[model samples]
Target: MKILNPFRLGLLGGLGVLVAVGIGQTVISLATILTYVGAALFLALGLDPVVTWLETKKFPRWTAILTVLAGVLGVFTGLIFAIVPVIAEQVRNAVQATPRLVTAFFDGTVRENVETALPWLGVQDLLDGFNEWAADLDVTTIGGGVFAVGIGIATGITGAIIVLILTIYFVSSLNGIKSGIYQLVPATKRAKFIDLAEQVSAAVGRYVIGQGSLALVNGVLSFIVLTLIFPAFGLPVKYSALLAFIAFMGSLIPLVGTLSGSIVITLLVLLFNGSPSVIAVGIYYLVYMQLEAYVLNPRIMNKAVKIPGALVVIAALAGGTLLGILGALIAIPVAAAILIVVQQVIIPRQADL
Candidate 1:
């Protein structure tokens, strides 16, 4: 018998492992694609009530779909028209006055605080270094960077449009797609899986509708408050409504949503009227957050997502860590699915035993 070479055997084993890993990665990518498809289908299901109502009045399916799409597009276009100009004007003003704001702030407040807090600290030297650094900073260079970012955002928007188109296509044929999937499962498991899928779809649909309603309410309230308060401070009132609307949309996400909204609003405030406006914005956000938590959230989200607060936080953190923003967005639905499986399948099975 010829002796096998150990080195050759070892190399072959490593190659096999690499091939397995590649295959596993490919499967994961495919699964992720399927998940996205399923999510789109669920969104369509959520919209089905509207579609059905239209059909009852003798509207064709295609016409109803077109109507829905048109409505969505109109809303988005109106939002852009309302918001972009205000933000642009505020940003321009902020950039022009940054140096003066920094000089006044350092000279009047920061220097005094630093000296009082730390007698041994070289407050004047630190201020000099900060001023030197600020002087060296080129606003033109920053503008160039912002322009590059705008280009990137344009590209991303194009990609998003493509994905939305695909999602619409998939959602339109959700029933057919689901039937095809059902046929693939073993006869014994098909019914169970179908039931599970329905539960998950319903849960996701409820969550989306509930959240959308909450966001709309929050946005309208913020806009009213900002419009009332901004004029008193000599800030542009027209833009405050736009800023508030943006903040409301941002507040749709779980833990980070309100914070992200606050950051955007704070920046806009600071841009328009410096540090004092920023401070006022902060107070507004704090009050809004408290009201939202105690009143708005409980009333809106209670029935939609029954998961505990701690679980929501954990799921959001884990999803954000594993898959970034998309993960965080889908985390609650995924958790709800798991909860359904536990309550419907595993627990019942155990009880039977």
Candidate 2:
């Protein structure tokens, strides 16, 4: 036994290392799966309000769930069918136009306009450096980037399908899932947990609905402005649809989404149209951003979840810093949920004790 003890210990140590390596590999493999599941869970929470509304109307739970699921799937399927081809065509147009756009950007007309618009800001030197750098490169250099973009598109489509399926399953079983989770808590705490959970789910669902509505409005407004200006800019109106879609998708991300989307769309316009078009875009978004903040957001999001202005900014910054875009997207709702729990559950419990 004494002689065998060291050998046994070494064997166990080797086995422990193998187990650790296996666990790491398994986690890496499941990273994508976890991401899909998390996204699906968020969607399910967001859809809970629709199901609850249907239930209030005397519809059975399964009936409500199925109806909402079908409607969502139909809308998404229709959009995918309608947009995929158009986006592919736009990508081709963008690729063909890049070199030309770069050439246009360094022209005298654009330089004069930029200098005139911002008298203190010298733009010619910047343009000259960019032109020099660009002249040393060619369109073929973008091939690898385009190929990566293609791969991203393919992966995104697959991920969307998986998330959709997972979302349906999660929503259908939401009550069961909640009940199962509640069972893990002590009986005394179960009621409070259930109430808090319901509030969180409903808030999240309303936030989703409100955000979607805001995105639609933003997209429509962007499309109208871009289209009206396109004629004067000597560009076709057809490209407006692509730009609108980009705005719509981008605006789904919270806080900074509008700015990011606007910047992107504006740059593309500048590339195709000119400095004048970029100025128009800048002016439109400036006024529109004010309108969105003071008018649209207050009316729409007021009913959804009301976190203080300061908290919203802090949460968004922290989320963005920690987890990039997804974190930012969910931060406001999460903050509201936490606030609700603190006010309703935590405070009351503390007071009672």
* Candidate 2 positional error at 26, Å: 5.9
- Among these predictions, the greatest lDDT belongs to 2
Off by over 4 Å in 1: 1-16, 24-63, 85-148, 229-238, 274-280
- Clash pairs for candidate 2: none
User: What is the TM-score of candidate 2?
Assistant: 0.83
Estimate, for each residue in 1-353, the C-alpha lDDT of model 2 and write its tens digit: 46668888999999999999999999889988987887788888989889989999999988999999999988888787887677778778887877865565655655665665556776867877876887798677778888999899899989989999999999999989998999999999888788888889899889989998999999888877777765666644446778889999988988889888988887676556555566777788888888998999999989998889899899989888866776787888899999998999789989999
Model 2: residues with Cα > 4 Å off, grouped in runs: 1-29, 105-121, 131-146, 228-238
Q: Quote model 1's TM-score.
A: 0.75
Which one wins on TM-score?
A: 2
